[model samples]
Target: MFMNSPVPSSIGGIKSLARQIKHATGASHAAALDSAAQTARFQNYAHAQRMLAVHVAATPLADARSDLYPLFLTFYWKDKESGERGRETLTIQLSAAWTSLITAQQLAHNRSLYDLQPMASDHLEGKHYCSGQMEAREHACAAARVFQFMDATRLRPSASYSRVYPSGNSRNCIPHSDHPSVWFDPATRRYLFVDEPYKRAIGEREEQERERWAISHLQVIAKATWRGMYNPLQQSGSQIYFISHAFSGVPVKPLVAAVDGIPLCTADHWAGESATATPRFNSPLAGQPIPKAKPVPRARMQHDDPARPPLTFHREAGLLLNKLISLCRRRAGIKTHLESVRDVLREFLMRTSAEEDVSDAEVLAIYEISNTSVKPILRPDWPQRSALEEDMRKLRGLLLQEFAFKAYGGALARHLGAAERSLGVWH
Candidate 1:
């Protein structure tokens, strides 16, 4: 559903109205444009009537704020005469068929928001002399009523608002049109973002700043209404279900099957090693037993590290692990065991570094032995490690052999020769 503000014929007209209202009232140019936009969009009587018909047809008998509610639509247009300013607000209720599909609670919730007091032109006309407090009180009261409808209907809260229009050279409508809104879930008392236009206004670099402000404001409101309620679901273990697309490459597998009015465990239920047990499948038509397919020999592996690595590496690895874990968590899919390979390498390095008494020759011999054992573990299809090793060897030969330990040298020749001999690479 859409919530639109009034549209101005030109940005200049909005600024002019702002200038006219600035001294007599404390209104800014931005505020004027926003007010003008809202009036144009939602105050038009004809648009409101049309929207009411649409809403009734779309969400008849449904709760006002239910998803079944048609877009909370609004529009902006100029008055035919005077050209002073105008706005329109329209809410299209849901049809009976749609309402029938949703549950009773959803219908109740939809009615609350959908049954708002119609947007009257008298409200806009009063703006000429009404104080900011008076106007704000009216807006808040209307919004509160909408919220009450949402609470009574028990609909999940969500809010959204559109961007400012009448572009360029116009006053910055960003501050005026931007609204911070939320749907209050009284059960948890959490105020989640229902409409946050400011987030869409700022560019990508300023997202964190905008999010911080939004989160902080929501927290304050949540704390006031219900102590420590702002992020309970996020902080707690709440499983949010989302529809998966085929392009996402997530595997879908059935976890349970219904047979002869009994629930049968699928292959996903058993441990990866317990794939041998074949449950008997009963067919209703034939009344004969059908053997279940054997579960594949799926290996489950985990990484065991004695010490956590540095924070930088840990953060990078944690991000990668999260992605990998998500892939592996899908039902019936094969989970690759890469964590074991990382753990083995980490342990080997730790052991080698700890044993300082070993001579350089002994260390080289150990490296050769471990390399033989570890090479097979590296993927044969990829040359990741071999390419890295070759690059390092080439760079090392160029810098240390050709440049640092060259036969021709000045006063440091003796020291260079000694260092090269110690490294056991000088001819």
Candidate 2:
């Protein structure tokens, strides 16, 4: 059945009606558009319907197919709008079937923004029906929900529109793989590029914290590196991460190239050591267990000055020993409560290998000192030579035990004992 023409060839009237229909993009405009179709103003009605469908395509849909296109088509031009009734052989039932054909085209038009193109020749599984064919339509059903997370993250305003990629421009309709380092979720109506940005933000925050720790702890080594770099994003292996000093497989370091023995950036540096990417870095194989610091031998006194007391360079004990030895040689003495203990330490080290550098730990098993005043107390002046010697002997035993000098004996231990016995006899 054809729609009853209300006006007799009213061209001006049709133009006026189309103007009114153009104003509405929602289903509320359907009644007015259908009424115009009955008045032989099908051009205006078709124009209005397509315009509304385009807007609908851009907006999120609760259900794409459940819209006003078909309802209005039949309301205006009943059964004739569908072209023909029974078709044993396929043939065009009518020449004027724009109302029926274009009404269904809303499904295609409603999806105008999304253009699906072959990303990679991956094994695609799809289904077919009698009406037509489909390519990646299956993705629409089982798509990943991304907007909820985006909303929660507040990275972008959830209520606002987001820029989708393949970009309707990138030449490829679908994302051609992804943003290299950024993860892309296929199911979200729009691709979610939030993961990489979040990871990058967090990575940078942690990197800064690691840098501060390294700069503070590594001290001079860090300063030397800064001086060598001359300031160009001076982040180092020791700065960005502590890097287990072993390959653990998450892409912390990138592979590098070198020119004339000078190193270049790694695969990670060029490609970007972004959160999603793995980079190879250059480092020495977890270097030989930091060679047990070869016990630095002391320098012998040039002339024995009785007043000054012929002294030898001392290597302090425990962790601070290395730092103190490195410093005391260049700078003047610093007075702490451990001053006397340090002096005693110097005397012990002077006579340590005075005979033969014995490597036997069990040779000198120490019994604990009965003198409990072992605290490193400050003394203004030396006591009588004999008293100091007696105290020194006890202190030496404590030091030997504390430093695990289990085998500290033989001719050297004999010499250390002898040297402390003679002094300026102060008492």
Candidate 3:
């Protein structure tokens, strides 16, 4: 990922050349003044400096400190809204790749709260925010990746060097040092950016903030990728469930009594009565009293009483019979046949009431015999009574399936066993 760049040919004599420029230009006075101004600025923003410095100082160095070497050089621009212009500052740092430099520039541009680059001295009303010292450090750290990449090249510098103030602005001019662009510390083995001011301003712990920022950026990227993948299915009513058993534990059924108005009963009322019952015992009377107990009359139980039609049967049959009687009264085309049909229905019910088990086949045989009796009064196209008998059979099957009676019977047996165990009862 490192961008290739031609190495400077002569780096050894750069120190002598820098000294010559320093002596000829006589710019030490100006440099001293700028340094004093920077110190004053740091003092004025003590809180910010402290925050950034502590962060930078806590960062772990990558390797043992060694000779410093140049990594990257970048420029920034600053403009004032009040028509007052600002001087641009070139940020120099030791990194392994140019990626860091690009990241730093992007970050600076994103932080709209500050007018970065020119190092504004005067605070503009409503326009000036916090100083860009933090932004500068951010840029320098990002650019460190370039230096790291460059160090891997292992090219040594030669002494032949030249000095030139590429710009005519006196305020923007900076001096070069004979020190290697970056050096590795023996104890920490980290390449240090020799700009003492910038390093101190950034401090060590700043990497944590950078890491947090990177994680957030990654989250955004992941979300965007997921959204893109699901875009085609957005309109369909489908949903994706991302379940994590580690965090949520196992799934379980809720204890509610019903789903959409259907009731679910537990073992407490399995058969609409308590499972246990008290036993009743009758003792034989003494010899003197036993003789008088023989004549006691037996009371008839409800099951042995005279058969009365079920309420539902009475209601529905009466309604159907009444409709047939109305047709007879109207003297409709099939009046006699309707009357015969009504009589047959009444006879069939009477016979069914006497039977212990009215199976479908038996019911169909009854319907056939009854239809014969009424056949002479009806048209040939009239439906046979056996059709109605078959309909009843189908209805019975549907009701049984809908209620799931057989399945529930098994469930009830299991629940009863569980309850028995809970009650410490065997059998």
- Model 1, position 73, has a per-residue lDDT of 18
Determine which window of 10 residues in candidate 1 has minimal summed lDDT.
250-259
Q: Candidate 2 residues 1-427, lDDT tens each?
A: 2234234123344445544655643334555555454344222344334323433575543332222221110000112444322111000111111122222212222121122211111101112111211111212211101111111111111111123222223342121121111212122222222111122333556546544432222111011111111111334322111111011111111111101111121212221111111222111222223222122222221111212111222221322332222222222232222243444444554455454453233112111122333343233245433444444444344343232212222232333333343222222
Q: What are the lDDT figures for the candidates, one per model?
A: 0.27, 0.25, 0.25
Candidate 1, 180-227: lDDT as tens digits: 332333333332332223223445555445333322111111111111
> Candidate 3 has what TM-score?
0.17
TM-scores for all predictions: 0.20, 0.14, 0.17
Off by over 4 Å in 1: 1-46, 53-191, 194-201, 208-427
Q: List the RMSD of every prediction in angstroms.
A: 27.7, 30.9, 41.6
What is candidate 2's CA lDDT for residue 235?
44
Better of 1 and 3 by TM-score: 1
Top candidate, metric lDDT = 1
Worst 10 residues of 3 by lDDT: 219-228
